[model samples]
Target chain A: MAEESAARKDDDIRILAFLCNWCSYAGADLAGVSRLQYPAKVLDVRVMCTGTISPYFVIKAFQEGMDGVLIAGCHIGDCHYLKGNYMTAKRFQVLRETLKFLGLEEGRLRLEWVSAAEGEKYAEVIRSFTEEIEKLGPSPLRKKKAEVGA
Target chain B: MSDLKSLIKEKLNDGADAFLCLKEEEGTLLPALITDADSPDLELAAVGEARYPLGKILIDLLREYPDKRFAVLVRGCDERALIELSKLEQVDLDRLVMVGVACTEEEARACGCPRPYPSEVALGEKVEAAPGRETIAEVESLSDAERLRWWKEEFSRCIKCYGCRNICPMCFCKDCALENPHLVEPGVIPPEFPSFHVIRALDMAGRCIDCGLCEEACPADIPLRSLYRRMQEIMEEKLGYRAGESAEEKSPLSFLGSEQDIKKLERE
Candidate 1:
């Protein structure tokens, strides 16, 4: 039991964040250049457009033990690819609701809009999201039934 | 009744391959492929006795003999199944002729079906039957805890026969997550209850045409249709998409939607 608790303490939360390359990714890079510090728990994947992010990817992340997922894109009409963010908005709406119906907490997934100029907003979003998830603790799905002998 | 017999005879008289319909043999009605148009056995087109997984059987035969064009008897459920199968590229819709038969009021009531008749009818009158969604209503009326408990109880009886998956016209996949050992452990009887069933429900989001075949095929008598019907409602409400409505409308989950699409689900 002591060994299990020690291992649990060492276990860091795994967050999967999908950032649109044109805006949110640039904002993330700017935060680094500005010497702004944030938690390293997040692993970022930059995509050409947030529209390309499938709900299947999000579901796969959860199934694989991702404690939280963040989707950051350009504000509505401000999409670099014109109407690309439209699809992202529609997909996540259904995805979030569907996840709730499946008995998952809606807070586990978060979506935000950050512009290239808003490095501070990007940092703030990440900080708040990470804190929110930390309070929620590790995803219940992460613990295996066999590990707890359930 | 005789009019249906003559309709089948006239349709078959053109010398197409075979006419597939239910035949009453020794008080049991089952699907039979009749080739001889002149045979008196064609008189047994029982309306409500049995419903074979005609779409699946048709797909199998069509695959075996690629060059043949066959005529099939379709009720509302069968038409939906055929439409779904066509989308999956399992059945060639162009090469087949659909002989639509409208279901009786009692039949429609028993199945709790809304559209108890196909879109285009070659036989039977288009009568208005009250859509019965009792299964969904029953589940929807429960509290969250009760709903969860109800589903847990219902799903606990799953034998993993794959009957629900096999009979589903929309479930035409080369690989399935339900069969994956990593996602669903092989030896588990109820197959991890909510996970297995929920995964399937999620997959059926925009694809299931509400054929009710999955529920019919379950040996355990799980109310699989209710779960899928709820999903169908959700898909329609969220995306304004309904399966089997048109071949051109792609499933929202399968495509990259617009920013307008995203706004519909976001908080104001």
Candidate 2:
């Protein structure tokens, strides 16, 4: 029983990450190849472009028990599809503010740019983001078993 | 003998196929779509506290009767709603006329609406609406933890009634994120905080005209207008776009941008 509760506490600190396929996904792959150790709490979803990551997906992540979310895209002017990252930039700005207004911690949602060659930076970001969410604890939206059954 | 009736009658005589206005019948104020100028409907045309999704209603009338031109009694917020609708091709502006009505001082204060008069005031004198920031101030006055606690408490009261979305003039989507089971989970009273309201706020970012109807419709009194108002401010600050301002200016979110736009946004 004690072991099960310890495992449950570890499971509570989940993060959902959306990585743009062209750059951030490659960077993450490079991090794995280089044996750069990062927290396993982040679960990644790869999309053609960061612009494709709608605010609904972010909201849904929190609703489904994600403690934090990270969106990584190509640097501006580096998008595989020209100008796709620009849309990502604008949407991310608005999404962060909207989430902030609703009382979500500012550190819970993050956006970063990682080139394919920047494997170390990708690992570093994941490490730091995991620590931040750890300090914040489980998401407020995280449903309890009693509440769900009720 | 209100100025609104004479204006409605004039429009009817001058080739308007129909006029849409509020009518007080047996102590109930309802939306009255009038065609005949002699039908005595103009006598009951009223301006009052009752707010309706008039722009949403006009979309049906205009599409159903494509050939007929109509006039609508519009308030400041209603005008903005209609203007945004026209941009989306939801309503044809060429076949419609606006008989604008300015809100009374008391009514404006009660609604906490800024700019209480339409561009062309066909009736009533324009009065200044009392500026409202009490809700924003109350939330801002708290620490992050307290603010979160306050929002959690406030959101717990939500019955998950879609009154805010239903009455909004700008919400014309056939597939709404708020209704999506994938986005907002089904069978939950007081929907998971920041999901339901956050989705609506994100959707309203570059679209909400700030009609204040959402706050009025919310049985929870969740200070929805303030949330959307902050969205509008962030939209302007980040993307330099304001919804319902111009028919020609597309929302910045509607399309991709150049490096210059992104650089300026970053600097801000």
Candidate 3:
């Protein structure tokens, strides 16, 4: 059992994507219907708006051993709830700077704009972000199997 | 000292309902509320080295007695906290009068305070601002892994006493985020590393007044002042906002400003 977990740890890079319901979620859906190929390791959570994504969720993702987190939503003026993404942009800066200051690699977390029509763009963001996270390797915050028992 | 007593007396007689200041009691200084001008406690009012969250106390007092007016003694840090708290709608500045007291050189040096005197000093000489970035610079100098390890080691000693939150003057939230079981798990000793401290750091980014009270209250000696001080620096660098700097300006995070504000920040 331990050996199986060890192999999984080496081969799997866990990625959690937070997609806003209005835009990014639709974008991901479009990517699926369009049969666009992306990393299978990526998992997603759908929220009503990007503004609802708290900094705590991002921190919790990393704490729970997520190797990478991507927050994709509508572009600045294109937000369904107008000005919702503005808060996301502002909050992203503070959260990114904070994580960077805490010695977390900058590439592990990312923010992007994916409109409902931008299926290709959503796939591309996932592709590139996965590559970046893979390069940075698993998060240092991830606890080993031995330590998990202790 | 005599001038401060007379000033308190004058304020009490001239419309102030009561005066709040520290009083010497058996060699220990305690916060005392002087309501009457002839109260014997008025004579014991002394600007001692001991510090407390007087701003937090005032918030409760002012809320309890809506119509009453107060004149409270303030150091530079205390004044800044009150100003920030007033902006957050926790304290009504119009109803209170400030009696500023500057810290001595020794006190300033011990605290590593950048601003040791309030805008108006009614007592003590205004000493030079102390350079308080040694810990920050030291941590910044280390590698990312080393820094993370250092913080983990420091935070592991936490007993989750919440003294830092309790003693903080700026903390007035009725529903505290720290107490939320979703954020901080219950029955965990020392709380989870980075989560407990990082949560606080994020919250304090644009609101901390750098009073060093959290560090003073911390039993673990976690260098919390430096952590929060770094948060303040990030606020200044990213958002061009510092808590307690100006009465007219508010923190950018406090409001949902126009799109131009975000553009301006991005362009920078």
Best by lDDT: 3
Tell me the whole-model lDDT of each prediction, alpha carbons only: 0.78, 0.86, 0.88
lDDT tens digits by residue: candidate 2, A1-150: 557444666346888989999999999999999999999888899999998888888888887778999999898999999888898889989988767766778999999999899999999999999999999998877777676563
TM-score-better candidate, 1 vs 3: 3
Best by TM-score: 3
- Interface RMSD, one decimal, each candidate: 3.5, 1.4, 1.2
- TM-score of structure candidate 3: 0.95
Predictions: Cα RMSD each: 4.2, 2.6, 2.1
Clash pairs (backbone) in predicted model 1:
A86-B258, A86-B259, A87-B257, A87-B258, A87-B259, A89-B262, A90-B261, A90-B262
What are the TM-scores, per candidate, against the unseen true structure?
Answer: 0.80, 0.93, 0.95
lDDT of 1 at A121: 92
| Model 3 residue A14 CA deviation in Å | 0.9
Candidate 3 accuracy as lDDT = 0.88
Residue A96's C-alpha lDDT in candidate 2? Answer: 82
| Ranking according to lDDT, highest score first | 3, 2, 1
Deviation from native of the Cα of residue A70 in model 3, angstroms: 1.3
Query: Where does candidate 1 stray beyond 4 Å?
Result: A1-6, A10-14, A18-30, A40-57, A63-67, A73-88, A113-119, A134-150, B1-3, B26-28, B38-48, B63-67, B122-127, B131-150, B254-268
Across B1-268, the per-residue lDDT of candidate 1 in tens digits comes to: 3366776777687655777778887788887787777776687765545566688788888898888778888998788878777877889987788888887777777776768899988767766667557777776676545665677678889888999898787776779988877667789787764457777887888888887878888999998887788788888888888887786677787666665566655644
DockQ of each: 0.31, 0.67, 0.63
For A27-140, candidate 3 gives per-residue lDDT tens digits of 999999999999887889999999999888898788767899999999888999998888888888888888877878888889999999999999999999999988888888
B107-137, model 2: which lDDT tens digit per residue? 8888888678888887888897766888887
